[model samples]
Target: MSKFKKKAEVKQEIPTSSMPDVVFMLLFFFMVTTEMRKSSIEVKQQIPKAAQLRKLERKTLVANLYIGQPTEAKFGTEEKIQANDAFISTEDIIRWVNEEKSKLAEAEREQLTIAIKGDKDAKRGIIADVETELRKGNARKVLYTAADNSNARKN
Candidate 1:
């Protein structure tokens, strides 16, 4: 009777093999749905033609500079930085550039770059002013992006 009772007992617990599959599925779902960072402002500028531009493998950091019509001042002017008492200045551009440069590794410092976004209607003087400020802030490697053209075959 004891031997028969022992044979009838059943062991019950969660299996281990399926746990890894569940974890992997969760990770894959998040990866596929992750959102990419985008510029808060848009530009309508014509990107200068470059014959020797090489594709970058990755972007470590980015500082956005919006060049367009001067911003309107409001009643809460004291709380914010204003430009020329009528427009918002490009003062923060340098600071942001420096912040991005600081994130580079010792060996990758030379590879740091800053992308400039300028509106089509924006004056060349504004762009030049922004460029001068960037140069003063030690950002020499600048790349200007253009609208995407999609008429090529996919490899």
Candidate 2:
């Protein structure tokens, strides 16, 4: 071949040896940053204020029960009990508690604490009904979640 003769050159391609590393890095980034919501709150609530406030020892062993006015007009303004994402009747609190407990390990079940988060404007009768249901469920521990007085209640 003459020194001046043109010749076909090999095509240069991007190296993919690092593609897996990049993909895995992205996967780990999302896994670490993404927060998966376990339940949605459909009620309007302002947790009551308390003189004393303490955090739970084991958050994993707690069942949350919410009592507040429905955010939707269709659900009416009456305070409705919410277990997980749906509105539940006071009579169903026992069942709801059992369902929540079932999600934990056997040892954690006994230590399960029923956390009642209620609206400050909610009626005491409804809360009393919830207490009755909790009694029916035989909940060993119950915690009434309230914000410290230092934290002003939202209007």
Give the number of the best model, judged by TM-score. 2
Worst 10 residues of 2 by lDDT: 2-11
RMSD of 1: 10.5
Write one digit per residue (lDDT tens) for candidate 1, span 1-155: 99998877967777989999999999999989986644333223344443444555575644445555433343332222222122245676677666667777777766666666555555677677777877888887777654544434222
> Can you give the lDDT of residue 35 in candidate 2?
71
Q: Judge candidate 2 at residue 61 and give its lDDT.
A: 88
Residue 148, model 1: Cα distance from true site in angstroms: 4.4
What's the lDDT for residue 2 in model 2?
A: 53
Each model's lDDT comes to: 0.58, 0.85
Candidate 2 residue-wise lDDT at 123: 89
The Cα error of candidate 1 at residue 84, in Å, is 21
Report backbone clashes per prediction.
0, 0
